[model samples]
Target chain A: NAGVTQTPKFRILKIGQSMTLQCAQDMNHNYMYWYRQDPGMGLKLIYYSVGAGITDKGEVPNGYNVSRSTTEDFPLRLELAAPSQTSVYFCASRLGQGARNTEAFFGQGTRLTVV
Target chain B: AQSVSQHNHHVILSEAASLELGCNYSYGGTVNLFWYVQYPGQHLQLLLKYFSGDPLVKGIKGFEAEFIKSKFSFNLRKPSVQWSDTAEYFCAQGAGSYQLTFGKGTKLSVIP
Candidate 1:
């Protein structure tokens, strides 16, 4: 299985531009998450979904929106790109709730540049 | 709110040197701890994890971590290091629920 797949490995956006970071998982996981990693900083949670059509904001949900349309997809939207929005984005999935029986699988990541 | 902290922002080691990276979390309830490694130009992958049972958990690439309840720490260690081990390491904590909080990653550089 491809596990978690993220589209557009790399993208550059101008100020005021918007784009969507697409994420898909083939494992049928119930939990999906979007996170961004800035230089020298830890990954910050942008948004998460427990299941299809159910999404929640995380610690760093500002400047972003997420939609979980189907069980396999959860896409993150940057309505207006800013310089601070430049970072490496990752999408992860977990098969179970919080149990150690399942660990989250991460996508390769999308490197975004906001100029 | 739950959060994770990694003391070291960067660590440099020589080949065959023993390595340790400190990770701590703030949460009153039971939790699961994990260590993930991201190699250059690669995705973040699980290095090891601790859920229940033994406090000492072994993971791939000859890595291990000990979960000390009293210290509130899950420290990753390797008896010996290899140049290939150079990568960015992240410590993440998950509480009663599946949502996880990650610390600022530690960049480990094993110099040959």
Candidate 2:
């Protein structure tokens, strides 16, 4: 099974443009997350969903929105792309909640460049 | 603000050398610590994690980390390094449910 699948591995958007980063997981995980990775900055959580139709903001939720329409899908939307939004986006999913989450399975990542 | 801090931004080492990467978190309550590694052109993967139980936690690939609450530290260690160990390591805390706060990653380059 494709653990976590992220679409448009690479994308370029102009300032003020909008786009969505698609994420789907076949693992049937109830927990899905969107994170952005920047050089030397590590990965910052952008948004997360514990289950379908339930989403929450994370530490770096600014400039992004997420909708969990289904348990297998949680897409991150960039409403108005800016140069500062350029970063590698990753989608991850884990099976459980609480501290017992075995581990999060990550996608290959989508490299987005906003000019 | 809650933060996870990695002391070193980068580290270089020769094969067979020992390794230790320091990490600290700002939150004081129950903490879930994790170390994730990203190899060249790859997605991040879990190296190990500590939610509770023993202070010392062993992970995949002969890697381990010790959680010292007194110091707010969860340092990753490896007895010997290999060229294949070259990767970027991130120290993160699973804060407030499943939300993760990560420190600036430490790039580790192991020379053969």
Candidate 3:
């Protein structure tokens, strides 16, 4: 299974630039998430979607926006990039069951650099 | 939201030596704990998981994690290390919500 897929393996952005990180899943999962991993800081949640048309902010949502227009796509947008926003971004998806969720499948992260 | 903490940022050990990585989690209600490993230049993969039963969970590649609910700890252990086991390990926590929180990963380097 192709699980989760993320586009633009690497990118460079100038300050104040904008870009979008695209994520797609083939497992028909109901939950999708975006996270950024900084050195020694682990992965912090930027946004997540429980299902189509339902999205919510995560731990570190600043400068990021996400939309879940379809079950397979959850794209994260950077309206205005900053140096602090440079990090490896990961997209994950999980099977949405009852009140609890299941294990997630991760994508090959996208490395972003803002200068 | 739940949060995860990993105690070690970096660890180096000789091959065949024992290994242990510490992780702690916090949540108000029931939580699902997991350990994810990322090899160099690869995506993260599930190492082990703990949900309802068996606090001691065994995983692939001879990895095991013990979940101490009373102490809010889940530590990963391996009896013997190999150079192939060198990687970055992340501890994660998932609650009733759709989100999963990860800890600052521990990078392990096993000398051959």
Query: What are the TM-scores, per candidate, against the unseen true structure?
Result: 0.97, 0.93, 0.96
lDDT of 2 by residue, A1-115 (tens): 7899999899999999999999999988888989999998888888999999999998789899999989999999999999999999999998757434357889999999999
The order by descending lDDT is 1, 3, 2
Among these predicted structures, which one has the highest TM-score? 1
lDDT of 3 by residue, A1-115 (tens): 8899999999999999999999999999999999898888889888999999999988899999999999999999999999999999999999875746478999999999999
Question: Candidate 3 lDDT (Cα, whole model)?
Answer: 0.92
Give per-residue CA lDDT, model 3, range B1-112, as digits (tens): 4778899999999999999999999885888988999999888999988888989999999999999989999999999999999999999999876768899999999998
Model 2 chain A TM-score equals 0.96
Residues B3-111, model 2: lDDT tens digits: 9999999899999999999999999988888899999889999999998999999999999999999999999999999999999999888766666677889999999
**What is the two-chain DockQ of model 3?**
0.76
Better of 2 and 3 by TM-score: 3
**Which residue pairs come into collision in candidate 2?**
none
The B-chain TM-score of model 1 reads 0.97
User: What is the C-alpha lDDT profile of model 1 across A4-111, one tens digit per residue?
Assistant: 999999999999999999999999899999999988987989999998989999989999999998999999999999999999999999986534356789999999
Best by DockQ: 3
Q: State the C-alpha lDDT per candidate.
A: 0.92, 0.91, 0.92
Deviation (Å) of A72 in candidate 3: 0.2
| Fnat per predicted structure, each in turn | 0.67, 0.57, 0.71
Badly placed stretches (over 4 Å) of model 3 are: A99-101
Question: How many clashing pairs does model 2 include?
Answer: 0
